[model samples]
Target: MSRYQQASHVFWRCQYHIVWTPKYRFRILKDNVGKEVWRCIQVYSAQLGCEVVELNVQIDHVHLVIKVPPKISISKLMGALKGKIALKLFSKFPHLRKNKMWGNRFWQRGYFVDSVGINEDIIRRYVRHQEKMERQEQAELALD
Candidate 1:
């Protein structure tokens, strides 16, 4: 199980599974470019107080599993991640900008996001039990 981080009052374990692809699903991320992207991800994630659980930079798409603090919203995080990575890549690999599709885009506008942690069944069972206990307590009081 993943460990939780605590704030002054809130305890959170927010992890997300994210996947995105380059514009048009081009296989631009390979070899040195892919390696650089990986490095930037690690560096930027730490800067944003996120723990990168797993990262896979494939030829056409990238996959990431990360734990982010509650303070950072998912949209904000994704914007920063994609924006910064694109800037860094265009800077290091100037040739990429030559292509029309790559002229102003790196990753596609949207990405896949899903919450990852704990089982839904566990939460359902916990809630049901609590409701049952509450109902039983109320019934006993009514009979008294």
Candidate 2:
């Protein structure tokens, strides 16, 4: 294969982090629509030339770690993923409109992104800690 073809054929890995919450941090994402929202994110990410490495859907927000090719711009990729997902989600879940998931918009505005390196330990810890933190929050809430 030519160099260009070889490069294109080779998988490029990147980690994309995204976070968005319901207006006023409402826990509307605990229902069936929550799963749908996550599926939408996965579909949109694939369309943007990325593979999801990990995803965490909290009660209020979401976190995603994805792998993407070098050819795609972060901004364009995020735009496509968030935009398409939001459009589809709001369309399918009409209640989202009432909640104002977006203040006249879908997603907040921007998301967090991180480049993963060879630090497997760090990545694992972060992913694990995400869940732990969620559990802790739930526990604390239960006490209240």
Candidate 3:
């Protein structure tokens, strides 16, 4: 079951796959930390009239499939999302600051985002595969 969004004069299904990681590739996102990051993304995305179709929060990176409106620029949306998450995470978990030895930053300087259209299902499958791969990698590392 898929739904499309509508504005005053336009009907659209503008979706994107966005991925980003923490600075220095730290593995600090776990337990309560991961939960807070998810919450922040959900709250911020909703504020922009966007819906999170799928989201995956890994220890070092986060991925999301978001349904956005055509009115907003992708860069603007990402900036707001990243900025809000960084501010909230820093405030909610002060210990996170210690990991930022180089500078007071949460996320890396850049992100990966792709527009999703007819290949939406393909993108979802890719995200799911990412989770599986990460789990397998962790299990293998644990055995080492």
Candidate with the greatest TM-score versus the true structure:
3
Candidate 3, 1-144: lDDT as tens digits = 546767899878888999998888888778999999999999999999889989989888998999888988889988998889888888888887776472778889899999998899988887868879887998999999
Given candidate 3, what's the lDDT at residue 75? Answer: 90
The C-alpha lDDT values of all candidates are 0.83, 0.70, 0.87
Compared with the true structure, the alpha-carbon lDDT of candidate 3 equals 0.87
- Per-model TM-score, in order, reads 0.79, 0.76, 0.88
C-alpha lDDT of residue 53 in model 2 = 74
Across residues 4-52, which tens digit of lDDT does each residue of candidate 2 receive?
A: 2225467444565556665566676767767987888787888765777
Against the hidden true structure, what lDDT does model 1 obtain? 0.83
Q: Model 2: runs farther than 4 Å from truth?
A: 1-6, 9-11, 137-144
> For candidate 1, what's the RMSD?
15.4
Model 1, range 70-105, lDDT digits (tens) per residue? 999989998999999999999999999999867688
Question: Which window of ten consecutive residues has the lowest lDDT sum in model 3?
Answer: 95-104
- Candidate 3 segments whose C-alpha is farther than 4 A from its true place: 1-3, 100-102, 137-144
Could you tell which candidate, 2 or 3, scores higher by TM-score? 3
Q: What is the lDDT of residue 115 in candidate 2?
A: 69
